[model samples]
Target: MEGNESLSSAMQERGLTQVELAEAVNTRLICAGHEGTVSDRTIRNWLTGKSQWPHPKQREALEAVFGCMAEELGFSPPARRQRPATEPESPVERRNFLTATTGTAASAVPFVGAPPQVGTSDVLRLRSGLDALMELDDTRGGHEGLERAALSGAAEALDKQKLGATQRIRLRLFSIAADYTATAAWSALDARQADRAQALLGRALYLARMAQDPVAEMRVWNSYAMLAHQRGALTEAIDSGLAAQATGITKRDPMFASLAHARTAIGHSNLGDRQAALRSLGHAREALGKVDRDQPRPSWMAFYGPAELTAMTAIVRDRIGDAAEAEAASHKALGAIPKQFRRNRALATTRLALAQLHQRDIDQACSTASNGFELMTGAPIPGRMRSLLGDFYRDLITLAPDAGAAREWGDRYRAEWSRA
Candidate 1:
């Protein structure tokens, strides 16, 4: 009941779908206020728990539909912390996590306290001070950049701390560092930069351990498993994924846990462990059922949805020799995703093409592969699609070597990707 079920049940008991409930809440907003206007996108954002409106009126609107006490949902909506616009966070770590997750840039921050009057001098001060520079770097690079800088900076900062003025000025720097490290490692993994990814992750793990934050620690383990899986290190990936789950396998974040399981399933399939693969996939689906969009997810985990899950299902089915089933799932996932994510569309499409090949649908498979190839060439690696594309390309070459068109396609892929 503490899961997505809470929202679903609340809606059902009230004879409402999420949309209907939100509409009712909006109606109440208009009745209670000067003007009531809500965008569908804003409603979706609220339901997803990515961000919330802090206005008392907005809270009233939410209560109108979701009920007065959010307790039944087993959570208190986190209160908004309004940092002053004047206290602009340093550029480095802020961009790393904020840009990718929230799409916000290095802009002024607004929060509850006395608005910080950040100035050129303040920026210059941090720029010149080693400790402040570490904080700034931690903000900009996220945590990944901090690892290298912290090693050098921490020694100097610590030496002067008791004797001078460090803690008073750079309050919350540790928390910022921890968050940044976690994100930095996460970013490297997305780009398929594994060595750098691992190195950054090492720093993240150490910091998370120091902070005793199991949530962050578990996330880094998940990152390690995912990156390892992408690199085709099956056993290592499986072990790392299992360790991540072990850190906290409660239903609190079943969807993310399922993602880790899905990663393990892929690794198992790579190792030819058919039974293990299927079992892990079931784990993925089961976990997905437990998430509520209204809770805060880790910064690195905001992308999962119907499309990504279906695409993953297609990949898993293909790996286990259910070509027709795989093709069906891939097509469904492709249809669900937006056109802006062209790279993912390509990756999913090629896998479907491979499935078509298995079914002797030669022309269609060729068509699909061609589209995927085009997508791969132009984009800098997409955040999510890069791994899937790598897997597809490697497998595509092995699929229909004797067919002339397939061979041509394979050769072209190799030359284009610099993997030939």
Candidate 2:
């Protein structure tokens, strides 16, 4: 790489021509919440070093563009206070990104020095503890127990090498988000609470950003957007889902795009955009086809796979009331999923139950949800998974009105929930 040069000239010398630089930088400034107008000629002046800086805001934007220290760029560095970041648009966002939630995925992902022997031990502790929590979950009530279990993981001691560096950081982010989403899944199992799941999963998405991991971030974001379906916050969920698509996962990871499309389908379904939902489903299928079977995937994404394409397609089918297709797809996925990942197997099985019970036989729906009940009961409640079922509960009640049975289940859940 050339020695760092004037921020202006560097932009010109790089692929970006001067006019392009001005436009791109100016647009970024606006996105950064700058209000002032900036022109290409003015940008040209800065490149020629004819004008030190046209504006403080413009200067700051240039600095971010170059990825070089301003001092190294042959210009006096902008004052520390100049062009300060504007307040985040939302308190929730403020905490996750600009403000505070948690950071270190960035530090964790990049392995430096001599890399240590990779072992399952680090993730093992988390995995085993998760196993215990799942084991403790009662089909009747597991979310509450799962919530405590998730909190316990936040305290798990992790070293830099657990996952370190930029690429690994994406994996790290996916893992944390997966854990939280699992916890939320359990919570949603009983309470049908999307908001709670959204908070935790959304935080996971933020963690991915800390590591600058976009692929992981997309999955995390999709996990949370499912909450939108539960809360009837259709627009918000779709918008949130779109963020993943916009982030644009490249490289070999088609699952990122697959997951995004699945969530988009859900959002479109909620908004009653039936065609859009189908379109998104097609996209999800295409994305799934692109995912290399043996490529590394995040633990959080373990719940999803080529098998999920069936479930995802079923979801769209179910939404459109194509009970026959939905039932077949769900059953296919359920059959394909291995039992080694029992936690996920349970959920997929339950989904199969959903398709059968809903489409073929009223008795079948009962049996399937009941079967799901059996698997989910003792299953570890990954918060995100429970969130996935929140709507299932609603749909179950609407279709079956098993008030007494559901109450019995709910009571059992509360008891175990209280125990946890």
Candidate 3:
């Protein structure tokens, strides 16, 4: 029997382990007044094609859990009553059909010898891959492997887009490609590979425009703003932030608008426009306050909630010479940030250290900065975080060239830096 790629893809998209899926199915089954007998082995069987058709009640529970038909999850009926695979339904049609028969379920047989077709299933599969990569980035930050993997995903989407499909599906594939390329660009940017990041963002923006996806386009422009800032093109950075603000998604999603405003604030602060920077920061906070926290957002944007916005505020405050306010913002960000976001926490720790250093709390700054190394002990520090540490080191030495704490902090970081 052929493996059930569709079901596997769906599970991956939901970030479900075999045990989790089984538990979910059992929960639904219990809610439907049926025995909760499904186990991890059952899910494994389904994935490995050891079970082509599950019990009828189990099928119903699966449908309820996934909000789609069993056939779409790659299950097939008995061979004696097998049916041909039909053309994939449009998203609207498929949703409507599924909703019309919510509690009922049936299975269909697949064609063993047919070549794989590019459709919604492929889209789901690619999206699952993207989700996994994004999670990896959250924990480890950016690396060469991540950049290459992201480019590979973009290439896969581009290749799939060349195949026969509806306009909607074609656009989705192009959008996926843009998202993947943008991820690659961000990875390179985090690694301080400015030239490589610039080239990738250019391609991502073109693909985003081709896909007519304002959210993806906004993401590209946000990255463009960051890349410009890294290259010391502060004016271009501000313009790019404005370009992000101009995207349609920013109008529709307050969270996106807030992020755009925050980016602009950074640019303005660095360019010595203290009044404009604070004004933009206020706008960012106001916009963020209007966002509906319960609304579902794409995985790529999982990083930009209150904690991230607060961190951005610290950046603005620090740039504009408000060390006390910057220190308070960094503390708030650290408290609000989730523990799973190791990279963000480490970066925030660096920011806290910077703020302390600026205030001449040399001993306290070293202590806070040491926490960054502890937090990211198992992983190589991202270049961006390393650069931040470098800044702190330079400032510390300049302020206290002969201090005992300065010598010890310098010696400690030198060892860490060489290892990194």
Against the hidden reference, what TM-scores do the models get?
0.55, 0.53, 0.73
Alpha-carbon runs more than 4 Å astray in model 2: 1-195, 248-252, 341-360, 376-420
Q: Highest TM-score, which number?
A: 3
Clashing pairs in 3: none
Local accuracy of candidate 3 as per-residue lDDT tens digits, 1-420: 778899999999978889768856754454344666898999999999999988888887676666676888999889885555563352222221122123433333354774445799878767766776687678878776566557766877887766678799999999999998999899999988999999999999999999999999999999999999989999999999999999999999999999999999999999989999999989999999999988887788999988999999999999899999999999999999998889999999999999999999999999999999999896678888888899999999999889898899998899899644
Please report, as a residue range, the 10-residue window in candidate 3 with the lowest summed lDDT. Answer: 92-101
TM-score of 1: 0.55
Q: What overall lDDT goes with each candidate model?
A: 0.57, 0.56, 0.84
- State residue 383's C-alpha deviation in candidate 1, in Å: 11
Model 3 / residue 26 / CA error / Å? 33
- Worst lDDT 10-window in candidate 1: 94-103
Q: What is residue 39's positional error in candidate 1, in angstroms?
A: 37
**What is the alpha-carbon lDDT of model 1 when measured against the actual structure?**
0.57
- How far off is residue 306 in model 2, in Å? 1.6
Residue 152 lDDT, candidate 3, scale 0-100: 64
- In model 1, the runs with Cα more than 4 Å from the true position are 1-176, 339-342, 376-378, 381-399, 402-404, 407-415, 418-420
Which candidate comes out best when scored by lDDT?
3
